[model samples]
Target: MEDKKKFLADLRAIWRGIIGDEGGHCPCCDRWGKIYPRSLNETMARSLVWLAHHSANGDWVDVPKRAPRWLVRSNQLPTLRWWGLVERLDTEDTTKKHSGLWRATKRGLLFAQNRLQVPKKVYTYNAEVERFSDELIAIEDCVGSFDYSAVMESNT
Candidate 1:
């Protein structure tokens, strides 16, 4: 029983690390969105279960939020009850007089990073990627226009 309890607790913590409770616009896609930490927790649970069965030797698993219904349904595994706990841990106003959106703080991000033991791969472009892309475009321009038909003929 003790072992079972510990496992559940560890699972829950892992979940929290992935789907952070804080809400923010997805920095990557720039789609305005919100994710409750509980939702993040749910994602982690599903991902870990998948990883356990599919590839034992792999060090990382990629979990994408593919279904909207999964998030909307509160009764799903990990439960809204856990979300309530997340709210308590991260929220400032119990009454929610402020905004309902809960932004992830630096502390929250660090906690998730440390607990999950996985690097957070943000999709948003950093300055370096942007600079490199710009340079590539300039190089392409300098090469002058290439005939598309010529290239296609060479392939044949």
Candidate 2:
């Protein structure tokens, strides 16, 4: 009975992001979910840095406020989320705010601030199965600070 209760509690925590049911490499091939440390591209790097600057105070940022339409349509947010750099606001209060809102994860802020170094590459996996996708690579020049001015300049 105690074990069952613990299991149920853990299951509930998954959706809350308190415990992860996703993430971790395959036990057979040992390649899925493998993380590599490659540099980020200018656009991706700038996006992360910019997000970090805005969300450093743990505030959620409006995604579409100044983002280019093309960028919004891109996989930037998903990619960042996959890399654990950013997260979508998922709380009861989320419905009160704009749907397109996000915030940087602690690791994201650290990486954007040049305080943390993460893998540059990672493999996609689906339900313990490795997906047929290209390995991720970091941008060539993403090791420095990217401020508001730089983000705006890139948009122009």
Candidate 3:
């Protein structure tokens, strides 16, 4: 129970570090904006969180599966509810199908890169997660494991 609490606390802290606090008006517009306190709405805050989560390797499961996991693990609403924010930012439909797999549209990528405004802490955390993923791959290489390179060769 203690470990779970610590993990949740760490996750929340990491999220807060990535996405600024809710309830603050947009610094750019200085208008009172509707902030997402429960991670359900489309706001700058949720965008950063989505960007960080999606940027991690092997985390690109389809929205249906991935969104529920995020909601369950984070105890917050699914990020898909915030897709409108991305659409608004890009003014385009970011849902695309590539070889039967749904992928981000070009506009989605642009929105993530330019509009998310992920904080330094979030960037650092993503870097660490990526490094961890690389380390796992290296360890697997050392074990003489059969490479499944052909399975998703077209993906690259």
Candidate 4:
């Protein structure tokens, strides 16, 4: 019985470490720390544009199966969230088989449409700490039509 209780406690602790808090916010954002700034790459910007296009009608969209592996494999989606460009739905994953739903933010749409001017670099923060880390990156060009072919062609 004691071993089972300890195992459950360990699971809870691990959950807290990964999920941070109930709102899905990371430790850095929780403290309102400054976000780190980094150069945006063409591939990521294009991905955001793609997201903006799909979620334009204000509907949450699933990450396409054919999406660039780097988007999820490399954690670009979370990076987008750091820039206030994309957001994930906070629904519980009871089956624990799917990643979750996502959508573009209003800011993201404007940026993708070339109406909003963001820095060539964007601010990002450390997910585990309340301070900005140099590893976070942001956006760049997203001009042209809402097509996934361009993204698919990229070598990333």
Candidate 5:
């Protein structure tokens, strides 16, 4: 049930910048689902943020048109639904086959709100990969000295 009257008030007091354009998800922030290494970490982090956002705020609400554009391109929506973080419903909106009707289920809300926890691990392997870093690091003269051959030998 969308309380039209309280919507603005509620958001003003507690908007977490989770909702993206179309207003149906929570975007990643605050390092809630952070994993080192940006290329591989973004999606993982976004999924966690989405779940947590929905779990914390389970209301009949939709994001306004002013939402961020990243949501439109995010794959986490389908991924989350597929993984049961949110429930999907068939919509008659023609523009989309489904997604007209969606709601964060109890499980979604709980997990997102962090009433539960998903056990996980992040192993950081510090290996120096040639002097092949960006200009900033080069300028700073930052170099990690490690035996690359030993690491490669272990893998082989």
Candidate 6:
């Protein structure tokens, strides 16, 4: 039980570091235009599902690998690989632009098949306002996306 709890906690921490609390948020938007969700939004989930369906039958899959435009444009799907859900196949050439095959890992398969349950959205916690909410906070709650460089080692 303790180990499972620890794993989930560590998951959140790693994702937070890899992504970030204010992922692509407009710091200048003073009016609190919208506090984006801290979980996998519909757009991202759809994209992942698309990948899963195309790569059915456990076959190695190739895809047009590019940082998704909507994710960048909407600031939603930046740090996807950090979740351990999807991975890039290693090609011999290292110095090349992103354009190749990527596959979903076991965890990603679980997610795609709905075996793993993660949160949908988490509310804002403004430290400046000294406020918090404790409804059903889960590991999937995240703000923004980043890369492996942002990964934080879990203190296990």
Using lDDT as the measure, the top candidate is 4
For candidate 2, write residues 69-148 as lDDT tens digits: 65566647656665678898765765564366787788877666555666665444343322223544333235443344
The candidate, 1 or 5, that scores higher on TM-score is 5
Kindly give the stretch of ten consecutive residues in candidate 5 with the minimal lDDT sum. 135-144
RMSD of 6: 15.2
lDDT by residue (tens digit), candidate 5, 1-156: 469768766763343332211233223233332112212124433443443453344443242232235654564455444334566566668887555234556655544443433322222212211121121111011112422242223223
Residue-by-residue lDDT tens digits, candidate 6, 51-152: 555454455555544435553355322334545566666677769765367656666555655546544444333322112233432223332332212111
lDDT digits (tens) for residues 18-54 of candidate 4: 5433324434445433334455556668778777777
Q: After superposition, which runs of candidate 1 have C-alpha atoms over 4 Å from their true positions? A: 1-69, 75-99, 115-156
Query: Candidate 3, TM-score vs. the true structure?
Result: 0.21
* lDDT scores of the candidates, listed in order: 0.30, 0.58, 0.34, 0.60, 0.37, 0.47
Per-model TM-score, in order, reads: 0.18, 0.52, 0.21, 0.52, 0.36, 0.44
Instruction: Sort the predicted structures by lDDT, highest score first.
Output: 4, 2, 6, 5, 3, 1
How do the residues 11-50 of candidate 1 rate in per-residue lDDT, one tens digit apiece?
Answer: 6565444434443444346554333211233353332223
Model 3, C-alpha of 63: deviation from truth (Å): 2.0
Greater-lDDT candidate between 2 and 3: 2
In Å, residue 66's CA in model 3 sits off its true spot by 2.6
Deviation (Å) of 60 in candidate 4: 0.9
lDDT of 1 at 5: 100
Clashing pairs in 4: 36-124
Candidate 6 is scored at a TM of 0.44
Report RMSD (Å) for each prediction in the order shown. Answer: 22.5, 10.6, 16.7, 12.5, 21.7, 15.2
